[model samples]
Target: MIATSVEQLLNNLEGTVQVKADRVSVIDSRSLQLKVDSIVYNAVFAEGLVRDTARWLLWELGQQLGIYPSSIHEFYMAAGRGELPKSCTVPAINVRAMNFNTSRAVFRAANELSVGALIFEIARSEMGYTDQRPTEYVSSILGAAIKEGFRGPLFIQGDHFQVSAKGFAADPGAEVNAVKDLITESISAGFYNIDIDTSTLVDLSFDSLDDQQRNNYRVCADITRFVRQIEPEGITISLGGEIGEVGGHNSTVPELHAFMRGYNYKIGDLQG
Candidate 1:
């Protein structure tokens, strides 16, 4: 019966099918509405210690007057929720990197709980992270999803991915080729969508407006263009810009609205 339901759900989706971050993401408007870029530094990383990450998040929670993040990010539990996020467009959360066992566990939980897709971050423990190198880590994560008979969009986003200078200069086309190839590989291996990243932009600047826009939009275009060409099956691709400035987009609504144009998103509605 569950298998039949899964098939029906897959058959229903259209156009860049999205599975809400449902159980995977713990949404916090405080973090979401910040003006500067802090998630990268504040957000959990695949390499950073999980316990430490949780503790830091808890510490930050201490700072909050009333708001709190439920779980910083958990691989298995998030994966299992399989709930569609509550967004008309591009609303999702990532569970991030969990080992094969954990991922598998999450998949089951998601199905039982009725959730959408969970995001996975597969990479090394390098200070300067990049997906230029290959890994079985991704394959392991996807394998779990396939086993669960997942029928939703499984996104294996290329998070914080960049190629080394030597790798890039040696064979100028190598990195691009590798990423495209990886997208195919992930899809075949059971991933739904991809997020290609090729930027060095980490933090935001209130001073260099032009530089910030340049850095953010350029990467968004590059990522979107990469997906447009690959042509994956059952996967909708999107480029994430505006890695910073959610804190009301510079302490003011008007400035934030102006800044959103570069972020590749917008402030909708004409309501106060």
Candidate 2:
């Protein structure tokens, strides 16, 4: 049954989950799937406070059940350091619509294949049109995981947390702050991976590659610092930097070098 209120939700979850004064305990693991399915449905489709409560309960339940939101940064770092052999490409799936069903299908497939390195992401643009905020997005994914009995780290990401070139050009502080605000919201909502797409600010009009990527790297560095400062104590958010805009000219080695040189120099003393 779709829960219409927090009271009804707890009542519906009675046989499967036990709630006692802020503590949630699982009583019947076998029946959890259906109950969680209802919770997620309500989390996504219910109105206002009902939706909020469902999402909050789902998050708490996931944590109690050993399904934690995590970062893929260390995994990628290992691959980059050559400590890991190239085995597979981890897919970052964007659930643009029907987030609940799509994510549920993803968990089902991953369970069948024993895959644990996939990501469920939502871009900044997608968030606007899809009307799925970071909290709702995360809840849908976690709820799917719970329904599937998938116990592990959930890599939810804020994909393409991009800076708008026009907005940045018009008012730099406001645009930068906008992206930072989204980052803060996403992180708070259990998004441990973030792709900062500042490549839109890259100016090809400049003669040198460094000059071209100057604004991009400078803004990226500033945002990176903000992310570092606000991230959870133990979790290091996996951050991606873009050197070129999508559909733009192919990125050359010089462009990558330039972006990295500027980004690293600007990001000095900040641990990634």
Candidate 3:
């Protein structure tokens, strides 16, 4: 059953967990796990401040339990340097609905399989229709981790942070700022892996491949710089850029080279 208020939620977790002076203490690990399931449910389904409080408590509990949201940047860098075996592809799951329960199941399966390189992601469009901001989304994922006894770094991602072509055409500054605002929010809420999709700005009317991807790479580079400037000191945010829109023409090798060259030139000495 979902608790209606923070007090009710605390009462429900009486023996399992304790909250005092803004600190959460786990009285019973096994029981707290079960109670966390309901906490996460309330975080996702409860209304108004109840939902907000639930999310806050869940985040606090997750911190105390050592379940931290982290980036996959270093791991990928290691892979790039050939330091790790290329045995499997990391799965990026988009949880549009049932954010808590679905994430719990994913965590449980990952725990059973000893998998660690899984990601929970949501797109900007998904965030709007689903009514899930970055904070709630991160809480849901972390709450699930706590419920399932999953430990270590949790990779939460902002997927397809795309710019709309029509909006960009009408008001380029507003459109870009919208994406930048979302990026700031997502990064603040523990989404260290961000995929910037400026492919919508790609102008195929241009003859040369570099010209075609000029706007795409330029805006992507701008966003990349913004991300680097605002990212947390110790953590390097993993970023991805798109050269072509999905369902459009497949990107050629030359197009990929063109995008990379332009992007690299744009972000001169910036390190991801």
State the C-alpha lDDT per candidate. Answer: 0.40, 0.90, 0.89
Q: After superposition, how far is residue 181 of candidate 3 from its true place, in Å?
A: 0.9
**Weakest ten-residue segment in model 2 by summed lDDT:** 1-10
Clashes of each: 19, 0, 0
TM-score per candidate:
0.42, 0.97, 0.95
- Report the Cα lDDT for residue 129, model 1: 39
Global Cα lDDT for candidate 3: 0.89
Q: Which clashing pairs does model 3 show?
A: none
TM-score quality measure for candidate 2: 0.97
Q: Which stretches of candidate 3 lie over 4 Å from their true place?
A: 1-4
Q: Least lDDT summed over 10 consecutive residues: which range in candidate 3?
A: 1-10
Better of 1 and 3 by TM-score: 3
Model 1 lDDT tens row, 198-233: 433423455655454554444445545655556454
lDDT of 2 by residue, 68-163 (tens): 899999999988998886876799899989888888899899999999789999999999999999999999888888888889999999999999
